[model samples]
Target: MSPAKAPAKPVRILLAKVGLDGHDRGVKVVARALRDAGYEVIYTGLRQTPEMVVDAALQEDAQVIGLSLHSGAHMTLFPAVVSELKKKNATDIIVFGGGIIPDDDVEELKKQGVAELFTPGTPLQDIVEWLRKRFPSS
Candidate 1:
């Protein structure tokens, strides 16, 4: 008799900060939480452009691309990243955002394929749980 094998682990994720967003305390917290939740998180440093973020995600072979934007440039940045990913034919990557984003922009960001948006004071456990369901922890 043969034993059944376990399923492969879910895809890894990249947590990045795009643009000149100096405030990274929240991003750091979430990164630690995600790592503790069993995801291989690639944390890109601050002031990255959309192209750079996408490039890092691609190079890291990440499945989930999370952007932490506090610079209020998300209106130009998030969509640009998404569009660049599309241009690169990277369709399987899931994107999300977190930061000091307004309510209206959050909806628009979702419409543009951001899976979810998290503002300040969002619980790290909640974000981790969401990733667990969305990407599944090994």
Candidate 2:
């Protein structure tokens, strides 16, 4: 019989609250959930600019970038984040978002390359499962 294969490393995710959004209770909860689920989470507190978010993700070598938005700036903020990631040649990182984003904007954000949207009330396990499937390291 062949030797057993080793389990893959947990995905590293950077969770950020960008563009002056001061309410981070949701992001904090999700960050803890991701950590408990075995992901290495780098939480970039509140009021981060898009550039800062990308920089931190790059510095941390994160495989995923999760943005928590609630300031009604998803339209401007998400695109700005994506654009900065492109400029830095870091577009390979899977980008996801969750917040009070409207349905139309969620579609538009997905079209702009957001991997998924975790709206209010989304189960925490759903996010973890999605990441594990999308970024399995084994």
Candidate 3:
């Protein structure tokens, strides 16, 4: 008889709060939800710089990088993280974010290569499904 195959590894997600934003409740909630949904989450606490976030993602070998920005600095911070990841040849790391971001800014960020932006009221299930669909196990 043929042997059974082992299960694939869980997806790793890196969640961070970049810049001067100290409010982390939202990120924490998302982190917990992702963990409960079976994703390995690495949350970098508040006041993290763009470089720091990208470095953590690289070190953790995360497949997704989710930023929770409530300080209205998504424009600068998101692009900075994307830029840093590009610099390190890590553009394959999916970049997404959520916060008090305006609609116009969301379009701009997407144009700049942000995979997606989840605003307030976005369901945790939605995020979970999205990740699962895109990064399904081998």
Candidate 4:
């Protein structure tokens, strides 16, 4: 008989709200969805800086950092987080975001190293499945 398959790795994702963006409703919802989907989620409360977010992600040993922004500062905050990650020599930790980012800036963000960006209506299941695909078990 064939051996049973190994359990999939539990993806550890750190979710955060950076800078003066006080909005938390959406990030809270996403955190719950990811938890229900069986991923370890760390939701750092509102008013965090890019450095604080990166530091927490590192301390938590998270594989991914999910930043949610609605303050229209995606252009600044997102890249700052990515830069902090690079500065800390934690490039392996992937970064993703969701918010009111303009479509025009998507490519630039990607070039600056953001892995994905979900618009307002992106299905939670899509987020779950995407993480699964990104961190499939051996």
Candidate 5:
């Protein structure tokens, strides 16, 4: 008889809106989608700082962080989140984001340790599928 393998832990993701961006409808929708997809999601709500996002993720023991931004602060805020994660020695935590970011900035963010970027209008299924592949339970 084959030995049974232990069940994998549920993928936990922390979703946050950093900087002064107050719009949160999109992030809330995403949180619901991720939750439905079986990911344990933590929503940090609006106007969070990068430090706050990282602190929450650490406290929650999240494996990923999904940032939502609309204040044109991708250049500043996204990198700040990445930097804070590095400082916390939590570089294993995957980072990704979506918003009205420009193509050029998307590449820049990816180069700066963001695992992925989803611009507005990308399907939510795409995000869920990416996570499924990135962190398969099997």
Candidate 6:
């Protein structure tokens, strides 16, 4: 008889709020949506530092890192997370974010290694689909 194969593991995504951003309604909604779509999500509650976020990502063995920022600190915070990930030799982890970021800032953030940025009114399904497409094996 042939041996049974193990089940495929669900994609692991770490969602976080960096800096002093306390408004978490949007992040919470994204978390729920991702979970409902069959992805394993780890949400580090409000007010996470870049260091805390990268560390959590490492500890969680996450395939993707999603930062929810609304404090207009994306220029500083996003790069910090990317730099920390590089320092730890963890650049393979995809970093993405969403919030009140301006168009010019979004382009620059992407140049700095943020995979994608979602603004307000971006459909939740779009985010879910993007993640699935970006990290298909995740």
Order the candidates by TM-score, highest first: 6, 5, 3, 4, 2, 1
Candidate 1: tens digits of C-alpha lDDT, residues 22-138? 888888888888877667778888888989988998999999898998878988899998999999999689888999899999999889978888888888888887877875445
What would the per-residue lDDT of candidate 2 be over residues 11-75, giving only the tens digit for each residue?
Answer: 78899999878899999999999887777889978999999999999999998999999999998
Poorly placed runs, candidate 1 (over 4 Å): 1-10
Worst 10 residues of 3 by lDDT: 3-12
| Candidate 2 clash figure, as a count | 0
122, model 4: CA deviation in Å? Answer: 0.8
Tens-place lDDT per residue, model 4, 13-98, is: 99999878888999999999998877778888998999999999999999999999999889999999999998999999999999
Best by lDDT: 6
The lDDT ranking, best first, is 6, 5, 3, 4, 2, 1
Q: Write the per-residue lDDT of candidate 3 for residues 61-88, one digit (tens) a residue.
A: 9999999999988999999999999999
Candidate 2 least-lDDT 10 residues: 3-12
Q: Please report, as a residue range, the 10-residue window in candidate 5 with the lowest summed lDDT.
A: 3-12
Write the residue-wise lDDT of candidate 6 on 94-116 in tens digits.
99999999999999999999999
Question: Which pairs clash in model 6?
Answer: none
Q: How close is each model in CA RMSD to the real structure?
A: 4.4, 3.9, 3.8, 3.8, 4.3, 4.1
lDDT of 1: 0.84
Alpha-carbon runs more than 4 Å astray in model 5: 1-8
Over the stretch 1-138, how does candidate 5's per-residue lDDT look in tens digits?
895543468888999999998999999999999887877888878899999999999999999999999999899999999999999999999999999999999998999999999999999999999999998771
lDDT of each: 0.84, 0.89, 0.91, 0.90, 0.92, 0.92
Off by over 4 Å in 3: 1-7
* Residue 130 displacement (Å), model 2: 0.8
